[model samples]
Target: MSYKEFLVQLSEASGVSGYEGEVSDVIKKAFKEIGHEVTSDNLGNLICFKKGKNPKGRKIMLAAHMDEVGLMVKDIDANGFIKFTTIGGVDQRTLLCQEVIVHGKEKVYGIIGVKPPHLTTPEERSKPLEIDNLLIDTGYDFEEINKLVEIGDVVTIKRQVYNLQNNHIAGKALDDRVGVAILYYSLQELNKLQHDVDVYFVATVQEEVGTRGATTSAFKIQPDIGIAIDVGFGKTPELNQFDTIEMGKGPAFTVGPNIHPGVFNHLKTTAKDHYIPYQVEVAANHSGTDAWPMQVSCSGVATGVISIPLRYMHTSVETVNLSDVEKSGKVLAHFIASLNDENMEELLCY
Candidate 1:
């Protein structure tokens, strides 16, 4: 399948924090088709370990979160309307009037309902709806709703993949879904090259809630180098030029205290030497990606980050450029291939 088609299938699948079975199934199937065996940790983190030629060589890790910001059923009212709570860092403002899929006993389709403008006071209309006031209308009565949905079932906004001009596409859950896509592309690229380091590509769970998956997985793998693939803010009129990256350029290589200087320099030089396009994103402290926890895991690890420029993050209409994803994966494969015993020692020295 094409990368975009796989990405859309991933985005449309429901996988909230602590509940990544559906997403795991899709990714595992893809990995298995490529002759890689998939394993899961106690925390639901999916791990695929590819052994390298050198047994004593350095262990490398690539991480991307699989969970996306969404909602969960908090309660079911007497009238059958579903009251829900936020999962991860959901924007309450965007939950109104959107179609949603509730993963319960069965897939339940519903729409978030809001007060009509005719009934609302002008002052109320001036403000966005709050989570407390939002209700999901499933068009099913209490008994039917209970039979299908239960409290704590996850709800994801339904968005069709809309292809835009150039290679950009719009949909929900692209924040780190694109990051997961990088793992797929990287695996394909790695198969063509000879690398000495055993690479572990992880599809982590519950990252939207916290970097829970990265923390535990890093401790388990304890790789010499960890690279987190994620999304960064894309260019928009309201955002500052210095704070956002332009779409269709390439992935962003981050530089900051949290990032290992040696790894960062290698990634930059690899991109340049190989003529792979890339942008730079500066982080003051925590990059808010899987790299955050991986850096401090198991006596501390050297961590790096690569982000695809993303528009409207954490919303249903999240946008990304497929070219950027392609470049990011290529750069990563090259960086991994460039790692050797001598350079790995130097990189870990400081």
Candidate 2:
């Protein structure tokens, strides 16, 4: 499938933290066509394994989270306004007056309700809007809304993918859904490779709340090398150069506490050897991807992170460049093909 098709399918799916069944099913179908041996962990992480040409080869794990940030219903007021709490980090300023889809009885549509400035005092208008004060309006009475909606139902922003000028794409859930697409496409390309390593393409869950899925999946796989594919911040007009990378340039290789030094160097060398365009990202502490937990799992696996630069992260209208997405996949495919027993030893040193 084309990247555009994958983006639409991934963005439209509802897979909040701990609720990844639907997304896992979609990904399993895609991998099955490529002849991968697919299975799921007890925690619902989808693991697709491909046998290598060399029998006693190193085990490599490639991880991409399947979950996205969303809200869960907390209460329903008498006027049918729904109160909610965020499942992940969400900016309250962006929640006001936006359309949302409440995954209740049958996917009810609603809008985030906010107090108009006309009704607010001058001091209140200048202060930040508290999350507790916001509610969702579904145009129903309390009794009627209660019949269709209930507490703990997932709620996601209602948005569709669209193409922008300068080769940028915008939509919701690109934070990690784009990572899933990259991993799937890379595995498809890697199926043609003659390698000496056992590869596992893992679709993890609950990364937004915490790297819960990766933690459990890595413990089960016990791979020698683990690589996490996720979205990173792209340079925008409002963001400083130190905080983000340029969009459409290429994928970013993260240098951080969570990533293994040798794995990081190998990724850079592999990208250069394959003539793939890539950038470097510096993260002094935790990388904040699945790599964080995967690194320390089961006697400490070699971990690294490859990120696709995305703009306006965690918002309904996240943006990414298609060229960067494809380049990331190529880099991963090449990296997997270049690994072997000797290189695996080198990776273990750092």
Q: Identify the candidate with maximal TM-score.
A: 1
Q: What is the C-alpha lDDT of each candidate?
A: 0.92, 0.88
Each candidate's TM vs. the true structure?
0.98, 0.96
Per residue, candidate 1 scores C-alpha lDDT tens digits across 47-111 of: 99898887786899999999988899999999999999998899888888899999999889999
Colliding pairs, model 2 = none
Tell me, by lDDT, which candidate is best.
Answer: 1
The regions of model 2 sitting more than 4 angstroms off are: none
Considering summed lDDT, which 10 consecutive residues are worst modelled in model 2?
1-10
